[model samples]
Target chain A: MASGIAFGVVYLVYQPFNAWITEVFKGPALPVTIVTFIFCIVVSLLTPPSTHTEEERVALVMAERNQEKTASVR
Target chain B: MVSGQYAVLFVIGFFVYIGLMILIAYMTSKKGTTQGEDYLMGGRNVGLLLLICTAAATAVGTGTSVGATANGFRDGWLGAVYPLANAIGLVTVAFCFSHVRKHKFRTLCEELQFYYDGSPYMRKFMSVVIFIVSIVWVGSAINGGANYLAYLIGMDMIPAKIITVLAFGVYVFVGGYMAVVWTDAIQAVLLFGGFVTIAILAIPAAGGFDNIRAAYEAAGNPGAMTAFGVGSKGVLGVLAVALASYYGAMAGPTAHMRVYTAKSPQTARKAILIAAAVVGCFSILPAIVGMSGFTIASNTGAESVLANPDFTFAYMATTVFPPAIGLVCLIAGLSAIMSSADSDAIAGVTTFLTDVYALIFKKPVEDKDIPKYSRIILVIMLVGAFGMTIFANDIMSYINNVIGSFTPGMAVALLVGRFWKRTT
Candidate 1:
């Protein structure tokens, strides 16, 4: 979700910014790279850390499998 | 049109590349076990480098290379928005869904099934959707490659497409996902190198960057020099295309398989980041080449490639570089198509076997039978894709319409299912 929002923000800004840079500054790459870097940083900051650890994920998978097996038996 | 000598070089180069891909497939097939998991997902142990290359290659296919360059020829910088958006979307996938790599799901539908409390309905629906999408994707890839082959070698479109499809199908049928990955890695290099070489050679041939801009201005299309260009579809259109391209990269079955096949979540995440950077850089090259082609045509009083922008890359390939380098560019364009075709073929077959056939019939194939069944399914899917190509007259528009219509719904479903606690 954060990534999606970040992409939206970047898309909204980048188009006009890219045009301005290309027309006035005659440089597209510098502005694009800068905007991309900023967008990535913002997205990384906004995205919450992973909720489940590796062990928790494995345990969850196992539990789901066991539940499926029980349901099938029923 | 390409000269006879260059056509010969292109054919030789193409066949040699195909032979190497087949050899790689054969070698990989011999070393691996023939289990369904191994064939379909590379045993879910793909490393970072291979993942990066395969994902990048799959995303940066004929659409981004030849198609985008052609658009650039007509629309200028606006033509690059699709790939630029794709690169951003890839990074978004890494940031948002890298943890999916930890799961052992074989197809996107399997993930959907798990999210929907094991309900098979969503799986069935998504399976059919992805299957059709993958087949269409394969056809588009063939269509793009055939255009290059037809233009470069003067072969008719159908025969060129047949040969292109067959070349990729043989390798995928023989080696499965592993072959696809290894070949994608090689093709990624060829694609990147080919485009970069053309862009470099084209600058001088078009009489430098300044001259190209001057010519574009002189042609009474000064807006083409701007970032938005004359073709900058309104803000909503831009956003829609961006989102569609993003969804295509993130939620599409081929890309979903890439996530599933990664060795680990961290590996997938890292690979996505690297691939995003590579794709972002590679996306601009086609635009550069296309813009150069436009400039060349304007300056030389040659026939405009604008009448069919899809031929812009091919026009430049034949006209801008030496015969040897031009041959490499043709092969690179072919590689772009093959890389996508092979990946989509594997994804389509995997979806059919696991999500559609297995779930609908409740009949799982034995491990010993996987390789044979996979080959059979791959062939059927390729043939089906080929048949569809006959009806798909405009490759880019067809792809865009399908993706634009379907992806937003898929993206919403994926986001809701993944993060919304009440989705089920």
Candidate 2:
């Protein structure tokens, strides 16, 4: 949801921002760079940090492997 | 027509390149056993550099080189929009989904299964969709490569397509993902070096930037000098294509699969950022080269190549440089096509072996059998792609339609599932 919203905002702002930057700065890089930076910042802030960690992921895999082993034994 | 000497150089250069790739595959395969996981996912132990190379190589396809330059020739600076969008999308992926590297997911279907709370139906559906997308992607790459070959060497398109598909397929069949990544790294370098050299050379040949600008203005297309290319699609249309292309690629099966091979989440993030920077810089080259082509065409009354923008890159390479050097540029463009084709071929086969075959049989493939099965599947996919190429008349339109229809929804799903807890 947050990602979708951030994408929406970037999409909305990019055109006008692009036009303004082209008009003022007379270059394509500055406008794209600025807008991309803004978009990344927005997305980073809005999206939640991942809850799954390496240790937990490893444990999950181990547990599944063990279950598979036991089932095969049966 | 390519001079006989140039054509011989092209043939030798192409064959030698393909032979080197196969040799790499042979050498790499000898280092380890070809278990399915090892073959398909690089043993899930890819370091940062290889990750960056494979990701960038896969992302910057023939479209970025040939098609992008073509668009630049036709639309001026507006041609940069697609690559710019792709760079932003890569950055977004790095920020939003880098953590995916921590998980042991293999295919987008597996990711979708997790996102949808272990729903088998979602996995099945996505597997089919991604598989189809992979096929189309492979076909498009082959089509692009063959077109370049036809234009450069004056070979018939059908034989060129066959040779293109077969050349890449041999390496992947022999070495699998390892071959794909290692060759991708080489191709990425070739691709960037070739295009940048062309851009640099073409600028002076086209009579400098001022002449190119004057030529564009004189062409009398509205917004020719502007960034958005006459605003034909308006702001919304441009934004839509940009966003759609970027996010769709992010959500693509090949892109997602790269995350699984990263050694660490941080490595994946860094690799994606590197790829973004590379792509962002590369986005301008094609437009510049194309615009230069436009200028030359205008001055020399060579409007036929201008009429068909697809030929701009090849035409410029042949015209602006000496025969020997132009052949190098053509090979570099061919590298762009091969890099993407090999990656998609692997992705398609992986999806088939993991998603379709495993699901149908209700059993995971044994490690010992993975390489054999993967090789068989790779050949089948190549044959399918070759068949599809017969009908692929317009490469860009086919690619755009596929990306437009599939990528946005997948991107949304991937984002929502990764960040939101209640996605299911």
Candidate 2 chain B, poorest ten consecutive residues by summed lDDT: B396-405
Question: By DockQ thresholds, what CAPRI class is model 1?
Answer: incorrect
DockQ of each: 0.04, 0.05
Looking at candidate 1, what is the lDDT of residue B66?
77
Residue B155 of model 2 has an lDDT of: 89
Candidate 1 lDDT tens digits, B14-126: 88889999999998899783466698889888999999999899888876787788767776776677788778878877887778776677788877665544545667777
Instruction: Kindly provide the TM-score obtained by chain B of candidate 2 when compared with the true chain B.
Output: 0.95
- How many clashes would you count in candidate 2? 0
**Among all windows of ten consecutive residues in candidate 1 chain B, which has the lowest summed lDDT?**
B230-239
By lDDT, the best candidate is: 2
Tell me candidate 1's TM-score on chain B: 0.94
